[model samples]
Target: MKILVYGAGAVGGYIGAHLIENGLDVTFLARGGHLKNIVDKGLNIVLSNQEKIVHPSYATDSLATLKNVKFDVVIVAVKAWQVRESATEILPYTSSSTLMISVQNGIDSPYELNDVFEARQIIPSVFRGICLVSEPGVVSVPSQCSWTLGEFQKNPTRAINSLLKPLIGSKLQLKVSIDEDIIKDLWKKLALIAPMSGVGALTRSVLGVCLEIKELRNMIEKAVEEIIVVAKSQNIILPDETLENSMGFYRALPYSATSSMQRDIEQKKPSELEYQTGAIVKLGKSNNVQVPVNSFIYYSLLPQELAARSDLR
Candidate 1:
């Protein structure tokens, strides 16, 4: 099947590399030095034990270059804030049969896609992995990665099956699952990540440091509670044990582990603050739920976020 991996950064590049390694037809849409590196020397994927390099069927920074080609599946792996713009750019290359996968961190990317594409064409997914781009065109996967996919609404099962078929038997130690209730999966991830990321950014520390301090740990707990209430306000009732489960997940992580959002903020790059922690505050207000903890976290980090985005003036 023909697939296009847009925003071929760490996540997209890693997935694209795997697909190409399995002999599937794949194209990559990336830009800047990363694009140059891939086009010149193929994409590199560094695993725990070894490294693999796979060149895609095609790689281009401009969609205009692929104007005549139609893609069967388009994986939207851009930042949460870049989803809508990416959707608009890729729309002309998709036909009625195209399946667009939303693999961003927040709960809003699918809705953002809905504005440009039909709901049936969108598959919302949650991705879990410890991966990053160590340099141009090189992705590092320190551990196994997994994806949980679910439809925004009822879609043709055959089409979904076709998309999953190539990924099933790969030697790449990747796990993929289909969830009947994907919304719950999205909220569960948000509950864990938003609090962890916000608190980590505020303190400029890793997950272990935040959890080790009494005051910061309490702040993290409160932030998680605030997200739970906000999720319920939207009629997406998370499990009663969400708080405990989230804490357990946090504790299990390596002490030095940091989130993508935290890393971006530390690098003074644009982050998903608005879509993750900030989304909680906005959703809570709209649903008449109180989320003071998240509000404080959001506002506390807004200055740095703005500065990074160059909107601080």
Candidate 2:
């Protein structure tokens, strides 16, 4: 199978390296420093159990090059903000039968993707893994990894098995669930991540840090409530017991674990304040839900970073 990894960051790198090992032809669409590094040293992926270095044919900074190319599947691993922009690149690489899987954070991606492509053509997928770009060409993280694929409508059988075929002898975790509540699951996952990561990123705190302040703990609880409210308003059915799930994950996760938001804040790079805290505010405003706390946290925490990214890039 021919595949293209549009945003070959940590998640893309992890999946691509394994796909290369499994003997499928893969290409990575990358640019700037990361692309430069990959061209120079190939792609490096370090999992807890194993390590991978794949040097497949690569393109540096151009999706138009993919215009003359063909791909059976295009796995988009770009950031949430980059999704629309990145999907545009796939126009050149995609054939009529190309399958697009959006394994992203926010719930709105599928609809956005469907605006350009058919809904039946987009697979609602999510990644339940911890991956970090430790350095250029090097993606490393601890080994609690999971990847799920499902159709947004109601069935997974038509959408997932062919994607699974490439995984027959690979070191990849692939699963197909027919859950009608995939969106709810995605929101539930975000609810957990946003509160934990948004609070942690805003405070520069870790999982262990949330344990210190009863007030912050309460704030975390409220942030989660805001997410749950939005989820319900969107007509997604969250598990009644879903509230504790995200927080529970925080407790079970490594104390030192930090979200991508926290990492971006520390690196002085652009952060996902909108999606985590910002999504809460955006969705809340539409539903007439007052998310003053998240709004306060987002507005207050983001200006500094906004000014900082300008200085850097």
lDDT of candidate 2 at residue 20, scale 0 to 100:
78
Q: List the residue pairs that clash in candidate 2.
A: none
Kindly list the per-residue Cα lDDT of model 2 for residues 1-313, writing each as its tens digit. 7888888888877777767777878898776787888889898777777676778666457776554677887888887767888778676678777778787786777777787777767776777768877888888867566666666655445645654566444364423343345677678778877777777877888867775688888888888887777777878767777777766776777778888877877777777666667888888888888787788788877776677567424
Model 1 clash tally?
A: 0
TM-score of each: 0.94, 0.88
lDDT of 1 by residue, 118-141 (tens): 998888989877688899989888
Clashing pairs in 1: none
lDDT of 2 at 95: 78
Which lDDT value does model 1 have at 155? Answer: 62
Clashes of each: 0, 0
Which is the leading candidate under TM-score? 1
Off by over 4 Å in 2: 57-59, 154-159, 162-164, 167-180, 305-313
Report the Cα RMSD per candidate: 1.8, 3.0
Candidate 1 deviation (Cα RMSD): 1.8
